[model samples]
Target: MICALTGVFPVTQARAQQAPLPEGARIVVPGHGWGHGRGMGQWGAKGLADQGKTYTQILSTYYPGTTLGARASTEDIRVLLETSSDVIASSDQPFTARWSNNSIIATSDATYRYFKETWDGTNYHGGSIHVYRGAIEAHQGGSSINSINVLTMQQYLYGVVPRESPASWPAEELKAQAVAARTYAARRKDSSRAAGSSYDICVTTSCQSYGGYGTKSSPTSSVTVLESSSTNSALDATAGKVLMYNGSPILAEYSSSTGGYTAASSLPYQKAVPDPTDSVSPHHDWTASMTVSEIEARWPSIGRLIDLTVTQRNGYGGWGGRVLQMNIIGTKGTTTLTGYGFMNAFAWPGRSNGLQGNWFTPLYWRGVLQSAPSAVTMYAGESKTISVRITNTGTASWPVGGNVHLATNSASSFATSTWISSTRPASVARNATDPTKSSVGPGQVAEFHVPLSAANMPPGNYSQRFALIADNQSVTSLAFTVGIQVLVPWVSEAPNLLTNASFEPSTYAWR
Candidate 1:
């Protein structure tokens, strides 16, 4: 959850008292909400009840012309219709369709004979019923069956579409505009290529998550049939379309829902799945983007955000695919920053069947300032003590569970050194907020102290640096240097040379 910030300056009293916002500058308000505001808003659904709307009305309104239908497979729709009761007598027969777990089979030979006799000499598919039954498997498993016409239990009770606007553009114009927008959106992927992407098809309750408003009675809706579309299709032309600042059209991708966006990639079934009823046969694949104007208009509080774009021609399979890039941008007119980026790929054959087709690997990255004390500098044979405090002022917290390193460099090129602490210096302390203490909470700090004793040590100034290491990620604190000043006598000449060490504290002595 920790995020870095680019450059941020607080709005001071002077700026506030100076003047109104400069023209053309944008102020982006950090909107506190999740997901793309779309169909069946959970909060909105609850609000419907407050407004005195029934559950039926709520579903109908959100679905817009979709009807309530029974579930596709169920027992309620089976029938025993008898058009002519006198035509058949079953005094010694029981009417039943036996079935194994796999399939159903007809047990009674009389039942088969009756069906065959009934269909004989009739206009039944230009073939005999006996011949047809012979072609079909019977009693292969542990069951028999007499098939009956069963209305699919599932039914979508669709509401009639209201009349369209009389003055709106004709259907053809709308379609063309949508197509153009989609085509343009798809082509915007410059150097990046899309390869090794996965795809997911969400339909029914299997792939799409279904939460029935806490109703105990299991409800059913019409089963949505999947149709392979050659390309992407617009979810809504009049309602959910993304519009430009002007009264113009913008390429918009509509989903039944947006699970949410996060810094880490989501698992196969963990992400939110879109409504599967859309058809892409007419439109082209598209990418996601945000214009400067769009950002300003959408986030009116944050004025024109500045951004540094890094475009990558990276794809899994090879070139002529999706592109990947990261754009570091300042938040609005102010200097605080964040990253905006996405990886997109072209639609290839058999690519629309899984979650990999559209990777939501978007990042909202930021930079943070880190500081630490280097190694403790002390005179050889002298005792030295050092301490460090790590703080975080960034939008996010520092990483937790990282290693803390304490290193020292000696002037004598001394290869042998022993640390008194039995364990690694980093693992001695624990924090409630972060056990590792590496992830110092935002506005939080951690401190550590280390003692070094140089016995019979050489006289010299030594430097040391402390570092934090977590797996492949690491951040080192500033270096803490200790100047070990040793007293040694200065020899004027060969006759004045001193072989014994000077005992005075202030005198410079040497061996």
Candidate 2:
């Protein structure tokens, strides 16, 4: 298996050196690991091999309960090399190919530019071959042709192991891959072809990849042939070994990398485990960026994207396991999708932004629904209670901890004597009538009644800015600016307050 899906999806958000996506900024995902996070991690195997672990140790670490044993038989395996097309192929030396029409073409030293021709329906499994110890067979389907490579297990692996793993990796790593690949291949009832198809596996990521013989890549000089010497030697060393469970070969699955930890799997043997060595993999850490427009474009029913939140995780490795399901919040409606469903929807090939794996936390754009007294005249040295209603719009709940409060921005010089500091004005306060409203969750509203006074400074026309703060971080989209008129105290009368955002010209008498 080139990529096997493990438990689910999940994420732990990061910031600072890796900053959070600003509200309404293009959505960016800081992610960890790659693949489905199942079974043996190839890069991890290499790292462990470099650390002096043997092939058996690497296998044991990944497939915990499986036993290593020799294969029951070394039957030939069929690999689907090309599908739905005309196949033109030849070998290094003398080789013969039988078409579906029972026609035979024999050639020698052909450069393998390939002799392309239309298909005639007669399938041949056993033909003649001297190159790579394999033969090419073409099958006729309803409307398309499927080209398959027929070869013995050893010859099959010669073209397989190197494509699945790096040919230059340490001997133990290559050997471990070879064994895993062999077991996986042996367990293949068939490739994703319809039942009773002619092939056992495929040369795509859908299955283990294969570099077919008779290509420029699979060159032969009568002395050396194809990809890697180290990988071939590893194949030879681990000849018929397979990972067996209950005395039968287990469907050994392996992926490129598992970030820091492997994800859980439905199969008991493919358990979640720490992969400390996989830091060497390039995909161990990654970040993918997609825009709000792109998301709404793909999932149009989700009108304007408001929030992308991962709800449940598998509870295994990184990101609190893997993401199981997520809610896509939008102005028009909401849509829930599994991790794979979301990835398949938003990210894909042929696009610049492709979400590599499901192991990620999506940080989205957010803005507050603020309802506050905008136009106001305050008496200097006199404080009055004002109400500001804040609707929680982000994915997280707004806690009432003193850490989450209303604060002044750095540029604000209109400080009032009642403020906690030059920066902080007041903490999130509850409605006295509703004492149970301790914290504000998503979509809920919280009321802030803070003392906004025109005090301790020269009273003049002033512009001031304040922001909703959480744990010392300013919520940028929640920041709002206001203009105020500060007059000298006038007979202790209450100041004029307006509910709407528009400010009106004030003609007031000063004491």
Name the best candidate (by TM-score): 2
Query: Residues 1-511, candidate 2, lDDT per residue (tens digit)?
Result: 0133354434432221212224434666767677887889999999999999999999999999989888634668878776866656655456666666777654464446657667788544343332445777878766778877778888788888988887888999999999999998887843323467678897777788776442332223243345577888998899989998987778788888888778766777988888989999988888777766777778789677666778777766545656778877676787988887877765634445666667777754233535545866776776666667776555444556445566675534455643445335576676333448777765566676655655564677776777766643334356776667887655533343333345468785543
Can you write out model 1's per-residue Cα lDDT over 1-511, one digit (the tens) per residue? 2122222212111111112222332221111112332333333333444456654554444334333322112211221221221222121244444344654544444444433344555242321111000011112212433222222111100000101111132333232223322222222211012431111111122222211111111113232322111111211332222223123322222222222221111222112222211221111122233234544454455554443233332222112112233333445444222212221121222233112223222211122223434434444555555555554322234443334333342322321243322233442133333664545554455454455556655666554433332222222223444344443333355334445544456755344
Clashing pairs in 2: 8-322, 8-323, 9-322, 9-323, 10-322, 10-323, 100-122
Task: Identify the leading candidate in terms of lDDT.
Answer: 2
lDDT of 1: 0.29
RMSD of each: 21.1, 11.3
Model 1 stretches with alpha carbons more than 4 Å out:
1-385, 399-401, 404-424, 427-439, 451-456, 466-471, 475-480, 485-511
What's the TM-score of each model vs. the native? 0.28, 0.67
